[model samples]
Target: MSAKYGSGGWATVAIAQSVGATGALIAELGWGVTGPQRVPRLSAVDKSILYRQSVSSRATVVAFAVLPVSVITWLLCDFSRISAIVISLGSLCLAFSPAWFFIGDGKPGQLLAYESLPRLVFVGIAALLIHYDFPIGWYGGALIVGSVTALSLSAICSHLGFFHWKQNWRTIRSQKEVVLGRAISGSFTSFAPALVGLVNPLAVPVFAAVDRLMRMALAILAGIPNRLQSWLGAATGRDRHLRSLMSIRYNCYLGLVSGLIFGLLAPTFVTVLFAGQVSFGYELSALSGFLLFLICTSRGFGLAMVAAGRAKHITISVLCAAGVGVPLLCVLGLYFGAVGALAGQILAETVGIVIQSRILSMKWKSNRQWSTYAASVLQS
Candidate 1:
């Protein structure tokens, strides 16, 4: 009993350190070095804190390793020059190795099948059929595989304590409405790669990395305003002060930063990293265009909708827009080439953002007015 207690105590400490580190790194990447101060240290007995710590640490290690390498690969396009593939594989091995060892799994197939089977099969099919290697087809296949991988594995890994966190089997966070919003958010990651995936399956790798990292960044950036608005909306039920204000700020900020980066420096970055063999400006352009749209919707619009209990409307709107936007980008790309193709992407997204924002802003205003009145009556 004494020996077992000692081991678990040490495990908890290790996990706490990991989460603190993860929070620090993400804060650095998203908001820069000057963002928020380090979160409070974990108490050994605090499971949530411990779980957060491990998640943070594992995430930081993974992001720091993957982000730079993906950027380099995007710029250089040469597998030989970038060294990203080897590093990523190696890094995964290292990060997961400790946790993997801690998990005693005598039933290997059972664990793999239940936890990771669907996603593994998806990737296997894509690779074996050269679906990923094929142009156009690669995008769709990769999107299906990649999005599902992040969603499902993140789900599984959490359950198995693979990231050193407690299992949270789909709370309100994973509700149908929230899940719908997340899918819309994920499309920004998926759409650009799918758009150009037909040309080279390998490109999906860099694209997926960039998309995931950027979404992570946006989530961090918009987190504060979104949270504030969400709380207010729940307590008060219609406060645009939190939702609408934050939405525009987040959206415009994403578009501005990403656009500037892609337009000004993407080609140069690609050149240095790819060793000048492959180019990624067009790829970056497509990605930035779609992501910019997402930032606009996510930062402000989506938060407002959920707070007002209008997630169903938001989800439907996103689906309809995607239905129109994706096909349009494909058709445009077919006729006009990649640049022209992305222009259509930009157009579709702008239209979607505008429609959602306007409608949601109105809802927010009306709801807040009613909420303020109710609060006043209660106080009286």
Candidate 2:
């Protein structure tokens, strides 16, 4: 897409992606965050019920949000209005994904077959369209087609039917804390590009470039915490504490190593991926890498807390981070451009890590037996 479209076009795509992602996050209703932990505990029948409730609740939210989200994208977009709106709508279609369902069910085959494969195929098709000089709107249409197709296949295979609105609403209310935390956290990341674009159009492409790479890498790294969520959720007593301790240690190492590698390789990645169209220097790339490390480490702590049923602490941390980060991101983007925004993200994630770690430590202190077991196990 970058090769086909220059900086201006890429900026518009970034804005559209931002708006669509924000809408999709709302439509997901925090299911992706909390679902994995819940799935391991549910019976087959109950699992189906949960999936139905999630779909029903998320569909209703998307029905209401589509128009407003498209309007927001249009307003933020300085390039092509039609293309932006289409892409925004395409992104919103991701709400239908049943990935969390499959993950929690320990069915990677289902996830790959029904969700990942279809999405990849459609994305490839979209690329072909772009290469052929087809309207960019076709790219968004392809996303919609891919997402809906995957949802349909998953639903049919899972034998899902009948969505009860009241039941779904109740489910949403039950998970309100998780939903709120995810919403705030998702917004800060998804909307940052648009916010920066509002201040510095020139910085949008550069910021968007690094942000895209960070997001892609983070998506792959997400498997670690997600796998831990399932493991910790299913475990009890000493086992759970042991897994949590291991998660913290390994995630810390993963963050340190991954951040260093990404910082060193980011310039080359930009040059290769964008054909040197996007100007990303070492200093900015290094800062973005630091931000990525903070994010990965913070996510590890937050997901561990969630697995331990400490959703409220995660929500509080997200709220605090947003309170500090949002204003800082905008101000920094206004003055120092993308570098300032990256710094703001790093600071926000640092705050989240501190709060989550503190909460987890408190929880450990209250559970003396588990804490001692974990410490001794680590020593051995």
Candidate 3:
């Protein structure tokens, strides 16, 4: 895209994706975060019910969200307004994804069938179109086609026909706390590209390009915690605690190694991915690597906390991180450009990881003290 449309056009696409991500989150209403935590213990019937409710709730939000998201993309994009809107729509349509359902159910086949495969086919089609010199806007159109197909496949597979909008709305309202927490937590990262666009529009090409790469890495790394959620959640008492500890340790090591590789390889990868149309330096790569490390490590702690029913702590940690990170990102971006902005991201992620680690420590201490008390009482 950068080769064909230039950096400005690619930057517009990146910002559109960023905005669309936030819209998708809003449409999800925190279900994406909470669904995996609950789905493990549900029966087939109960899981079906949960899926219906999620679709209904998200559908309600999407109805209201689409217009605003399109408007935002139109306002934000400096190039190719139509492409931006199409990409944003595609991103918003992901609200219908059944990925959390399959992940929680341990059904990789279903996940691939219902979500991944359809998208993969459309992405291939998109590549062909791009190669043939179709308008870049068609790439976004392909995304829309892909997402809708995936959603249709999911609906067909599940046989979910009815959605009680009223009942689902009530359920959505009941989960306001979790939804709000997720929204606040997601605000900074999801909107970071738009924020950069606001301050340094020219720098957005470089920053958004790097941010897009980091997001892909983060998604790949996310498989770790997604796997661990089921592993740790399915265990009991002391076993669960032990699993959580192991999960965190494993993620920490992976985070360190991945961060190193990311720092070393990002410059080359970005250049290669963009066909050398856009690129960044080692310094930016290093900062992005540091940010990735903090996030990857903390994901383990966050998921463990969720499994332990300490989700409130995760919310608090995210709140603190966003509160500090957003402003710092904007201020640093204003003065130091992309480098300063990346530094701010590193700081914010660091703050979040510190708070999360502390909370886990406190929980461990509390658990140990309670175990000791119970043992003494039994002995007496």
Candidate 4:
């Protein structure tokens, strides 16, 4: 897509992506962390009820959140407005997805079927369209078609007892804090990229392309560890402190190795993949790969924190990172364009991971102390 559309076309696509991502962030509302943490404690019956409530609540919130943004994007970018709206609407499927249920249940296959399959189909259709030279503007519509198909399949599966959903407003209300934390954290993360688009129009495509590719790569590498964390959290009859420590240690090791390997390879991959159209992407991809490693190392700790009821800490860390990072983004973008923006991202991630790691360490120590005290009391 970047190759065919050039920077201008990719810029439009980037705008659409930002809109969709923003909606997803709002829809997720911190459930990515909180759901996994809380779901295990509920009965199967209650899980179904919560799932339905969560989906409905998030979907409703996303609809309201996306509408104004769509309108604003429409007013601001005449050419890409329709595409942006279509893409953003398609992202609503993410809210309805049963991955959270599957993850909570320790069912990876179900998560893959409900979440990954539709995305794979979307990719196939997109590649076919792009190969045949379909109009670039229509590509966003393709995303909608794919997402709807995924939603329909998921719905069918849920009906057949492969997944669960049972509406309950009260349960949804009970999760208000998680929802708020998710929205705030997501907003801080999403704001930086959107700001990049506004500050440097030309850089949007380059930055977006690299970011997208790096994210795809990281998802593939990080999927297993991510699933494992949820499973470990939900596991019973085990030393949770030991599990948490082991998970963090191994995850960091894996992330460090993966980051280094990908960082070395990303430049070559970018050069070949985009046909040199996005030459600047090589450096950005390298930086992004390193950042991905840092993120990977922190993922276990972050999930552990959430499982320990530290979602607020995660949100605070993200906000602090954004506070420090956004100004740097604007300054770097103004002075050095895309490269500077990429540098700003790296800086921000570094700050975020440091803050997060510190908090996680504190939480771990607290958990250990409390565990020792409880053990002594039981013995006495």
Candidate topping TM-score: 3
lDDT of 1 by residue, 1-380 (tens): 10222222222222222222222232222211001111112223443333344444445545554554344333433322222233222223223221121111122343345434654565456445443333223322443354335434544653533333344222222334534543553242233444534443333434433343444445445434433342333344224355446555665766566655555555555445433443555566456545554554554565555445565576566665666666765665556554544555566566567767767767767877887898899999
Worst 10 residues of 4 by lDDT: 160-169
What does the lDDT come to for candidate 2? 0.83
Candidate 4 C-alpha lDDT tens digits along 39-111:
7778777676666566667666666776776775565454556765665566544565566667767777876
Indicate whether candidate 1 or candidate 2 has the larger TM-score: 2
Task: Go through the candidates in order and give the C-alpha RMSD of each one to the true structure.
Answer: 16.2, 3.9, 1.9, 3.1
Give the better candidate number (2 or 4) by lDDT. Answer: 2
Top lDDT hit: 2
Please list the C-alpha lDDT of all candidates, in the order they appear. 0.42, 0.83, 0.81, 0.66
Ranked by TM-score, the better of candidates 2 and 3 is 3
Name the candidate, 2 or 4, with the larger TM-score value.
Answer: 2
**Comparing 1 and 3 by lDDT, which wins?**
3
What candidate 4 gets wrong by more than 4 Å, as runs, is 75-78, 130-133, 160-176, 236-238, 371-380
Q: Give the C-alpha miss distance for residue 30 in model 1, angstroms.
A: 20
